[model samples]
Target: NGQSTNSNEKKLAFQNIPRLPREVTPFASFTNVIELDQRGPLFQGPGAKRDTGRYKVRPTDDDSMKRAKKFSMEQSVKYVLVRQQQHQQRAQLDLIKKQQALLLMCR
Candidate 1:
């Protein structure tokens, strides 16, 4: 029983021993499989050498004007469609009322 207790204590001590750092281990190779450039344009401070290869073209005045014109055209089209639908509904209601009046007169 005493020998068994000593073996258990030895096992516990073995388990407590710290392993090597992750960088030194075989698993470390998987950690850096895909190295990404984490620094984006936002993180790059002002006056930092910009990557000329990438064009960061912002919306120009012409582009904004075109967008506004397109938005107004779309809004006008939607308004016309809504007005047409309302006109159709009003016409249908008027026809129903005329039919009801004719039925009452006949009765």
Candidate 2:
């Protein structure tokens, strides 16, 4: 009776083994090669038109405008600094001239 029970348990274990579908055999073949006519942009879908011009225009113009504005702001700031330095130098020269005039009168 014990031998019979052991045989039944072995049959149940064999039935529990996993199986793949018969249509997908392990010996099936696959290829990685694509035909030349089928090659196009990877992200684009089948039968979709490519728009090359629209993507090229907007970002370049925006970058140039930003660069121009930055250049103008830098030029204006430099001009203001030069003007301040010139004014300060002129004030110092005027002070020196007034001191010289006072010394001449004292003599």
lDDT of 1 by residue, 2-99 (tens): 99999999999999999999789876765446777867565667879877795555679669889999999999999999999999999999999999
Task: Report the CA-based lDDT of candidate 2 relative to the real structure.
Answer: 0.89
Clashing pairs in 2: none
Per-candidate TM-scores read: 0.44, 0.46
Candidate 1 RMSD to the real structure = 13.4
Q: What digit string (tens of lDDT, one per residue) describes model 2 on residues 1-107?
A: 99999999999999999987765877657657876775766675777987667555588899998999999999999999999999999999999999999999999
Lowest-sum lDDT 10-residue window in model 2: 49-58
**Whole-model lDDT values for every prediction:** 0.90, 0.89
Worst 10 residues of 1 by lDDT: 27-36
Model 2, position 23: C-alpha lDDT score: 54
